[model samples]
Target: MTEPLVVEFEVDAPRGHAFDTWTARCGLWWPKSHTVSGDPAAITFQPRPGGRIFERAADGTEHDWGEVLDWEPPGRLRYLWHLFFDRSEATEVEITFTEQGGRTLVRIEQTGWDRLGEAGPPRRDKTRQAWTAIGEQFRRACQ
Candidate 1:
């Protein structure tokens, strides 16, 4: 297995603001290229343990991407993620939000690529790139 994919960046907003942007306002910042449907009408996290993380299309079609494992507003969120994969190949992702001089530092740690067998490393690399770009997108939205 490869090391967990880690990505960190700062948001101009405070911790709670940043966290809210990431969760409540996700449909506004999330890029279509990063979504399972590419153009989901809405993407949402159900906000509690065992809750669903999913996408809904304009046609009302829904597809689940993950499940919430832990939820701590303005502090941390841990979930099982399987965006374009089967649930059997789900990975774990934990994101933390920390306040820094009025700003928020967001960190994402994702692991469990080993389940994908030969496709693991490359998928992990792709997600790393996606997260890096998303960090910037997320920051702008938080402001």
Candidate 2:
């Protein structure tokens, strides 16, 4: 089995507020172009346990992209990512928001990847880069 890919960042925002912003309104900060549909406007996340992280296309198509495994407001969220290209391959992701003074310390830990084989490393690296970029974008958006 492949090891997990972890990524973290500290944002200049309150932990509670940051957590709300990330889960309650992911589309606002998530890069829509990064989605499978390649449409940013379609991205959506429901910030509740058993909720969905999905996309709604112009054609009125709602494509489920992930499932919320755990939802604790202003603290942490764990989800299952079942991407389209490989429906059999699933992964778990957890994002935590910790308060430090006034800033929010965000940490994203992802694991449960064993299906990609030699492609796993590259995929993990890609996820790391993508999450890093997304975190940066979120910071900029909140600025």
Candidate 3:
């Protein structure tokens, strides 16, 4: 097994605002390049454990991305991220929000690639790239 991928973003917003940018306002900054549809009507999180993180098509089709495992607002979120994979192939993603001098530090830690066997490393690499780009967009949006 390999180490979990960790990526961090420093945003110029309060903890609550930063967290909300990732959760409530994600649709505002989520890029088409990172979406399943390439052009989704919306990206949504259900705001609680067991709630779905998904995308909706213009025609109202819901594409499942993951299930929220932990949903502590302004501080933490953990979820099972399947994205294009089956639920059996899902990986875990944990995110934390910490405040420093009024700025919020958002950390994303993705694990469980071992379950994917050979496909694990490449997928991790790709997700890491995606998150890196997304983090920049998120950071700008938080501004």
* Cα TM-score per model: 0.96, 0.88, 0.96
Order of models, best lDDT first? 3, 1, 2
Whole-structure CA lDDT of model 2: 0.80
* CA shift of 3, model 2, Å: 2.4
The local distance difference test score of model 3 is 0.93
Clashes of each: 0, 1, 0
Q: Look at candidate 1 and tell me the lDDT of residue 36.
A: 74
Candidate 2: 10-residue stretch with minimal lDDT: 36-45
Across 64-115, the per-residue lDDT of candidate 2 in tens digits comes to: 8888989987888898887664545668899899999999889899987677
- Candidate 1 lDDT tens digits, 25-86: 88889888878778999889999999999999888899999999999998999999998889
Q: What tens-digit string does per-residue lDDT give for candidate 3 at 12-38?
A: 999999889899888889988777888
Candidates, ranked, TM-score: 3, 1, 2
lDDT of each: 0.92, 0.80, 0.93
Between candidates 1 and 2, the lDDT winner = 1
* Model 3, runs deviating above 4 Å: none
The prediction achieving the highest lDDT against the true structure is 3
RMSD in angstroms, candidate 3? 0.9
**How high is the lDDT of residue 45 in model 3?**
91
